[model samples]
Structure formats: C-alpha cells, structure tokens
Target chain A: MSAPTLPDLSGHFGRYGGRFVPEALVRALDELDAAYRTAKTDPEFQAQFKDLLLNYAGTPSLLYRAERLSARLGAEILLKREDLNHTGAHKVRNVLGQALLAKRMGKPRVIAETGAGQHGVASATAAALLDLECVVYMGETDTERQALNVARMRMLGATVVPVTNGSRTLKDALNEALRDWVASVDTTHYLLGTAAGPHPFPEIVRDFVGGIGIEARQQCLDQLGRLPDAVAACVGGGSNAIGIFHAFVPDESVQLYGFEAGGDGVATGRHAASITGGSSGVLHGARTYVLQDEDGQTVESHSISAGLDYPGVGPEHAWLHDTGRAEYEPVTDAEAMAAFQLLCRTEGIIPAIESAHALAGAARIVPALREELGRTPTIVVNLSGRGDKDVHTAGAYFGILDPVETLVPGENS
Target chain B: MSIAEIFAKARAEERALLIGCMPAGFPTVDDSIESMIAMHEAGCDVIEVELPYSDPVMDGPVIQKASDIALGRGVRTRDTLRIIEAVAGAGATVVLMTYWNPIEKYGVNAFARDLAAAGATGMITPDLIPDEAAEWIAASDEHRIDRTFLVSPSSTDERIAMTVAQCRGFVYATALMGVTGARTSVSSQAPDLVERVRHANPDMPVGVGLGVGNGAQAAEVAGFADGVIVGSALIRCVLDAPDRATGLSRLRALSAELAEGVRNPAK
Candidate 1:
C-alpha cells in the first residue's frame, strides 16, 4: 500500500484542522509552512535534526516487554519507552526539530506553552542547546504544582511566565503564548508544544515526532518477528499518540487506540474525553472536538495528571475517530492510578500518570481480546513519560507519604 | 445607516469616524446597554458590541477581564443580541464584534439573521479571514450585513488586497502587530498599513484599532485613517469607575473628548 497522507493543502484532516487564528498570524503561518517544506528536504537540516535526536536527546528509546504483567493479564504487552528520552518525555523530539527550524528561518527566539511542564523543560533544553532565547508560558496553578519543572526551565535559561488567566492551566498558557506570537512573529517562532493549533503546527509536530513510530515499527519486526495487534497511547493534545500512530496508519492489520483523561468519569462531566464525549468546535486555533458547554464556552477539564488536563485533543485525532481509523476510550483517574501502581509493582517501571492512562486502556481491552481470541494478542503502549515528575501527586493519591510523615514528629522529636 | 455610509459621512465632514467598543453584559446586561447608549449619544458614530468569550486570545488584559466578568455572569449570545437591539434602537450604528467559534457554534446563518433582526449593520470578526469564511460571507451577503476584516502591519500586499476585497465595511487596520490594548504611542506602522489598504482599494474605508486610548492618540490615528476604533481604553474607563453611574459618566466624557479629537486633528 502507498504511504498514508492527510491534511490536504488547506490543512484539513478530513474537516478537522484549519487555520482559525487572527489575521495577524496568517503571514507567519505561511512563512513557517514554507520554511518547514524547504527544510524537510535540505540534507544539512535533516542531518542536524537527526544528530540532535540521536546524540543530544537520545533517540531509539527501548521497546521493553512487560513479561510479568503480560503473564498475569494473559496477554503480551510491549512498551515503547519514550520515558527514557532525555528530559523524561517524548516532547524533546518535536522541540529539537522546531528550534532548529527556527534557527534555519533566521528566528532568534522561541516561545511555548506547557501544562505538566514536560514540554516546557524540553523546550528550554532545546533552546539552550541551540542558543536561542526561550520563553515558556505556564499556568499559575501548574507552576505551583510542577515547581521542579519551573526551576529546571529557569536553570536552562528559559524565562517561565505564569499565566493567571481563565482556568490558570494549559489553555490559559496557550492563550498567552498565542498573544506573544502575534506580537513577536517577525523574530520569534511560537514552538507549539503539541500536535494541535493552526495549519502547519499539527502537521509539523506529527512529522518531527513520527520518529517514534518509525523506530517502533522496525523494532517490532526485528524483536517480535511481527507487528503488534494493537497500539495504544494517551491523548491530551495527542502529540505522542500521533507521533507513534502516524507510521502505523497504512498498516491495515493494526488497531489504534487513544486513551483520554476521564478524570472522575465522563458521566460525571469532569473529564477531558474530547473524542469520547465532546462535540465539534474550535479552540486554540484548530477545529476539533472540544469540551464546551451549551453556549460553546470551553469547559474546565479536571484530571489528576496535569499533562492530560486539557479540554481539547489534536484535530487529527478527531478525524481519526470519525473515520474509524482509531478508537478512543476514557480512562478514569482511579483506573489509571491503579495501572500506574501495577506497572510499578509488576514491571519495576513507574509510568507517568498520563502514560498510565494508556496502560489502563490496554488493560481494559486486553482481557476481552484474550477471551475472544483465546490467544495472547501483542499490544504496544506508548509510555510517553516517566513518573518522576508525578511522584508527589502519586504519593498524595496513594497516601504513601502522608501516614509516614505524620508518624514522624516535627523538629522537636 | 450602513457602516460605509457612516465613513462616507465622516469623510465629507473632514473628520475621522469615532468607533467605541463595549462588551455585551459587562458589569451587567442592563448596565452595559445603558453605558453603550450613553457613549453613542455623547459622540460615537459607530458602536462595536463585543460578545464576551471564554478564551479571548486576541484581547489584552483589560478586555479579557471584562469578558471574563460578562461570561461569569451567565451572559449568553442571546443577551449580546439584546444589547445590540437596545443600542441600535437608540439610533446608534451597531456592529457585532466576536471571535469565530461562538458564531460557528451558534450557526452562522442563524447568527447573521438574529444580528440583522437586532438592527446591527455589520460584523467585525477578528479571527475569521476571507478564505475560511465562505459560510459567513454567504450568510452576511444573504442578510445584507456588512463584513469588516482586519489587516495587520505584517500583512503582505497580496493579503491586503484579498482582505479588502472581502470587506464590505471599512477594512480594520490593526495599528500594531499585537493583541488589543491602549498604548502611549500609536504604532508607526499604522499609516503605512492604511496607505497599503488604500492602494489596494481606494474606495475601501480604513479604520485603525488596537492602541488608540485618549483624545491625542485618537487624533494621531485620525490624521491618516477614516475611523479611530477604541476598545480596551473605554472598557478601562468603566472598570476603574467607583460605580455604574461613574462609569457611564466617564465613558461619556471620554467619548466626547475622542469625538472632538477626531473632528479637529490639528488639535
């Protein structure tokens, strides 16, 4: 079969993605589109991006088989270990590509928005390595929760601006970043952190990060002697999912699954299940499924994992769900936390709460597949990040530290 | 009167058209209508009623705060239309300004029909360009509603021509390349952008917004454009007021000052 292609000239992924920004950003988007088109073909640019991915960010992350969990669940489970990448997530790949592209385009500075601070740290790292002025806009709430990430970004020489608007989360940070981009488009590139936003951004992010799928596909063939039956990844803005799913799009034998943050549950109206529960709308310059109310005001999404606490997913995910190219399921906080602990106990791997959502989704479906097929179905879950950043939240959730800390006395004891 | 007619009349009188903006249901729905009507009576030739949105990316802090208040108060699209109906009933040339999502969600044709029924003469869609606005263009044309598109300083000549061709009212020349806020100095790029718009279509009226705050700034923009649009500064007048009455009076005073400045550019 021919290679999978999407997002026609107008940037529509089957009526999903489009340029929904103000007129001030049109020229900048056009320029970025042209520059990316040219840079993708330039051998020097390709070599530089590849060098950074391999040498600096450490690409070709491990694909480990969770033998204990697989044996217990009566299914074969494999993990694409993006958590091992430098900065502890898959965000660095895209950031490195965009930052290099910024330099190639003669842009001296870059800006980005981060939620869990994973993207912010990755962007800061790229900026430091590339010698470009970097700024990261984060929600005020996020800065307080992800304090370690804030310090890391500052240490990397990227200014972290806390946005206090709206819900004071990823969406608000995105709004501030877009405002900055509009003002500084001539000299700065808005390094969008996800496979979202207007036109070239979603496509560009997917292409740069598609290396995950490219490597995983080859690894699956060499290591497993065949492709996996299903691939699963958590969907916030769906960058990692798209990155890993892009290479498998033309493989008709593979089934793709995207696990959205269910928070409490979709029925309780407190989840970020844009595909599972949302309607079609526009947010952050892209037409996609959004968590909005009756008046079309974007609703606040609640999730224990800051990385997945967004009201919208990338537009291509919406199109994929509509076209039946992929299936999306909501993974509740309880289910994800359970899977997080299970992965820790069984496999000696502490997955990010966001990645745990994908694990939870795989757990939900694997038992059924085992029952139906009466055989082990190989499942690949994209472990998008490490749980190091989420240790505090996990400890609080499991009450692991509270009882112990309370048992110990204060300084007097 | 049509938006074009307002600009033509202002041109014939050798003065720039003074356009005042206020978000609908700000402070409160009734109070916002009263404040806008007061500004129109004082001197505003055209009143742009902003439909408050949850995520107003193009707006500055002042306008964002105002919109937050309005949305927090349970203001809906229907309430914004009521403000337009009341303001237009008071003999003000009313235009609805909003981001594109609300209109898309509200149904473009339905929004156009309701806007026309409320006596609004035009729309200023900040986020909607001509290329992606075929639905809105058809709707507006069907309702005979004027469509005003924004042109920024960074806009290329080709972009300027395309935007102006789709504009039915005056082309909204963004004074600077930033979100809306009152500034101390009008952007140096404003006149050049206005000239570029004129070169594309001389008959198309050009209105500059995104920075004009006080009378002096209005006069500076008035020297080169057909309309001076002020938003964040006017909202700030109400926001800083001690009471609703004080806000209305301050808005009137600011409107009168800006109106005078537009008429007497040499001052």
Candidate 2:
C-alpha cells in the first residue's frame, strides 16, 4: 500500500472525515480551507504561530525520563510534559493557532464548545491575548460540575452560555456552537478545540498540535539515542494523541497507541470507547466512530473524565485504527485512577485523569512489549494535561474532600 | 402521486403548495399518524414526516423537544416508515425530512427502498449536501425517490446551482443562516435566495423553509417560492396543547390557516 496521505481535497481520511454540516456553513468552510492552505506554507504566518507557541503558550515542553516510575513497570518510560504548558494542558496550542487564524481572517469574534471547560478556558486565554471577543457554549451539567473552570473562563473575559438541550453534555454544547456559527459565520470564527469535526478542522487541528510529536521525536533521539518502541496518549476526540502521533506516522518503526476512557468498563456497556465499542457514523459535523444505538441515534458516552466523555472519536483516529497504523484500548476508570495515584506517589506528578488513561495503558503494554521486543522497551507517553482541574473529582473519588451539603443527587461523590 | 405532480396542481391553481411537517411518533405513533392525517384533511397539500434522531443539530428547541418526546416513547426508525405509510394512505403527498445518519445507519440504498415502499415520494436532507451525497444520489435514483437538497442565503451562486442540479422533487432554500424555528416575520433574504435558485434553474421548483410561523408569514413566503414549508409552528400547536383533543383541534386550525395562506399568495 502507498504511504498514508490523508484528507484529500474533500477532507476525508480514507472514509472517515468529511463535511456533514449544513449548507449554510459551506462557504465559511471553503474560505477557512483556502486560508489554512495559504497559511500552512506562508513563512510569516508560520513565524507568528511558532512565536506564540514558544513565547506565549510555551512549546517544546520537557521530555523527562521517569526513572522512578519506569522501575515499577519494568520498562523505560518518558513523559511528554504537555501539562507544563501555560494553560495547564496541550489544548492551549490549538486555541492559539485558531485564534491567530481568526485574526488573520479578520473575524473579531471567536466561539467554542467545551466539555470540562479546559478548551473554553484556553480559548478565552488566547482571545484575551489576541483582543478577540470570545463566547463559549458549555453543557449546563458541565457548568455545574466544573464550576471552577466556568468561573475561570468568565474571569478571562469570555461569556459562557449553558446549553440545556439533549443529554445536556458536551455533544449538546457542540450542537449549540454549530447553531451559533451558522448565524454568525461572517463575523465570528468557531475555534473548534479538537482534531475532530468536519473537513479542514481535523487536518487543521492535527497540524497545529503536530508540534507535540515533532518535538517528542527529536527529544527521544537526543535522550535515548533511539526512537522509543511505542508512543501513547489518551484519546478524547484524539487531539493530543494525534498531536503526538502525526510525526510518527511516517517513522513506521514506532508503534502508536491511543487509550480511551472506559468509565465503568467496555464490557459494562457504559464507556467512551467509540472505536472499540461503537459503529461508524457522523456526529458534530464529522463522520467517525460514534457511540450510537442500532437506530443511529447518538448514545451518551460515560467517562469519569469529563473531557473524554464525548461520544465520537476524531476521524483521523478512526482511519488510523482501521489501517492498523495505531492500537487503541480502553482503560477503565479504576485502572486509570490507580495509575493516577501511583504517578503522584512515585514520581510526585499528579497527572490529569484523562492522561492517567495513557499512563495506565503504558503499564498495561509493558509485559506485551517485553515479550514482543525480547528486551526492555522504551515508551513515550504524552502526559497531556495537569491534574489541577481534576482535583475536585479526584478528591471526591479518594474520599478526601469534604462532602459538602450542596452536592447534587447522582453526582460522582 | 409524485411531489412534482402535487406542485403542478398547486401551480395550476396559481398558488404555492403548503407542506406540513411533523415528527413521526411524536407523543405516540397512533396520535402522530392521526395528527398528520388531520393536517392533510384540513388543507395541507403534502406531509413531511421527520424521523426523530438523538442528535438534531439543525433543529430548534420546539422540534427538538418533539423529537425527544417521540424517542422517549421508544419510537424507532422502523416506526417512522410505518408512520409515513399511514400518512400517505390518507391521500396526501408524503416525503421525509431527516438528518443523514439514520439513513446511513439503515444503509442508504435500503432506506431509499424502504422509504419508497412506505409511499414516501422523496427526502429533504438538511445536513447532506451535494458534495458528499454520492451514495444518496445513486440510492435515490435506483429507488426513484426525489432528493431535495437545501440552498441557503449564504450559499454561493455556484453552490446553489450545484445543489439544485442534484435535487429531484424541489430545491429547498433556507431563508437565513440559522437553525429551524418559527419567527414573527419571514426573512427578507428568502426572496433573494429564491430568486437565486430560479436563476440557477428556472424549471426547478423551489421551497422556502425556516422562520415561517403563521398564515401571514406563509402568505408572504408563498408570494415568492414554489412551496411554503412550515415545521416548528405546526409542531408547536400540538406541543403546547393542554390535551390530545386540544392538540388535534389546534393543529387542524393552524393547518387550515396555513393552507388558506398559500392559496392567496401576497404576490
């Protein structure tokens, strides 16, 4: 087979990604496509983007060898410290790139859809820096659950609209954002937060965040004197995973792994493992692996990490899985939480629950790699975010936080 | 009869056709069928049965609520086919308005066959554009069902021409760049979009949807387009009713008023 070149002019990854949005957004998409194509090769645009990533968002995040944690797993592990970015996550890279593009396109307003408000906060940060008007659509349930992040977004001078439709979650927020974009496409830019959604977005986001892999590849060579046997990252719409995986796609020798959130467990029928447990369909303007019922209606996904609770995976991840270029596995909440606690105790790193899935998957693959490689395996795991935002949930899970009287019924506690 | 024949009849009467839209199995399967039949009996020239899906991105709150009620009642895709058959049996031209996923999940060709078998004349897809409709185009052709793709006020002239060429029944022109909902006044952009569609293909029939609520709004839309498509306002009659009898009575009254509005175009 020929080398995997993706998203032909139509924005398809094999058969996974394409525009499935309303006709009203087509012109805007086309204009975006044109601008992105031009900006991709423009030296001035590249210079500005690189400057923002390096000076503002702080790119080239450290690639630290986790010797203490590596000893426990019996494998050499390197952690890509995306957690150290200015916004406390890899999402800052994407928002900055899109916000810059919005400025270039002369769109003064930027709108975004967020789940746990990580992306919303990042977008607001970039908007504040760029002097753009920012509005974020968040699920009403998420606003209540992640009230701290909501307040942070507001403090950044962004308006947060609570969406109350459908399941009242991330998907609803995405739907509401699309609704807003339809009416405001001329003056506003939808700064989509992930490497998902219609054509151009999957490609654009991957390109913006592709620096993760580009940096990691060089770091691995410099530190280990060889490429790691495998690379792993958590997949929620697969932005960070794709970010770290893109540069490895052509390497062919390196293995790429994506760990999805298994809320209860995949067997329990309540996980966010779209590739492992769902079928091919369209949602949020992209055709990908979606957790849907037999009748094709989207089935709500469950994950302890609100960021990974989306029902659909990015189209590029679906394509990668289909081609066997990457491996995906579900890491149950219990297993992820175990990894979370282990990382804090052993390495003094409190990783985000979303990134804990990747850490857990790294542990799970140690024995398999040992058997396959006939020696100790070197693995690079993308620690995509910090645990600061997840302190409340983790505290509640460990029964360490005070059980407040205001806790709603059926809340995690 | 075909959607074209229905439009031809309305054209002969020197009036635009009024197409009434209702979600299948809203409230319940039986009541939804009864409601559609009542609309036809009152004055609607055609019935558009919407299949309720979990994620309706283009729908406004009213239709979304109705779809949720239908899905909550366990109305499945197969039930929608049955509803279409019943509504068509009542002697009104019937079509389906749906997002693309359910049909893709059902298998595109299989859905076209089943829709044709159920007496649906065509499908109006809000999300499926001509650029990504190769499979649907072929399936619709093989099953001989009309494919009505939408052209929006934001659609470029080239895009409008491309979208209208794939359409078989009639070209749907979204009046504004917004989701479906009833408004106090029809958008002024509707007339311009209709004019653009006519320029794209003079022979192709044009239907205008979005933001049209009462008879006056319908009459204003009928003045320029070939068909006046009303969804949210029609569904709202049943949605806000106090009881089943009241819902049906209100639906009949609105249907008649909208029907009368189409008969006497403002033009």
Each prediction's RMSD over C-alphas, in Å, is 1.8, 3.7
lDDT of 2 at A151: 96
The DockQ-derived docking category for candidate 1 is: high
lDDT per residue (tens digit) for residues A1-413 in model 2: 33246888899988889999899999999999999999989999999999999999888999999989999999999999999999999999999999999999999999999999999999999999999999999999999999999999999999999999988899999999999999999999999989999989999999999999999999998987889999999998999999999999988889999999989999898999999989899888889999999999999999999989999999999999999999999999999999999999999999999999999999999999999999999999999999999999999899889856786788965
Q: C-alpha displacement of A244 in model 2, angstroms?
A: 0.1
Candidate that scores best on lDDT: 2
Which parts of model 1 have CA positions greater than 4 angstroms off? Answer: A1-3, A371-374, A403-413
iRMSD, per candidate, in listed order? 0.7, 0.7
lDDT of 2 by residue, B1-267 (tens): 799888888889999999999999998999999999999999988899999988888889999999999999999999999999988888879999999999899999999999999999999998899988999999999999999999999999999999999999899899988999998888989999999999999989999999988999889899999999999999999999999999999999999999999988997
**Candidate 2 structure, TM-score to reference:** 0.98
Find the candidate with the highest DockQ and give its number.
1
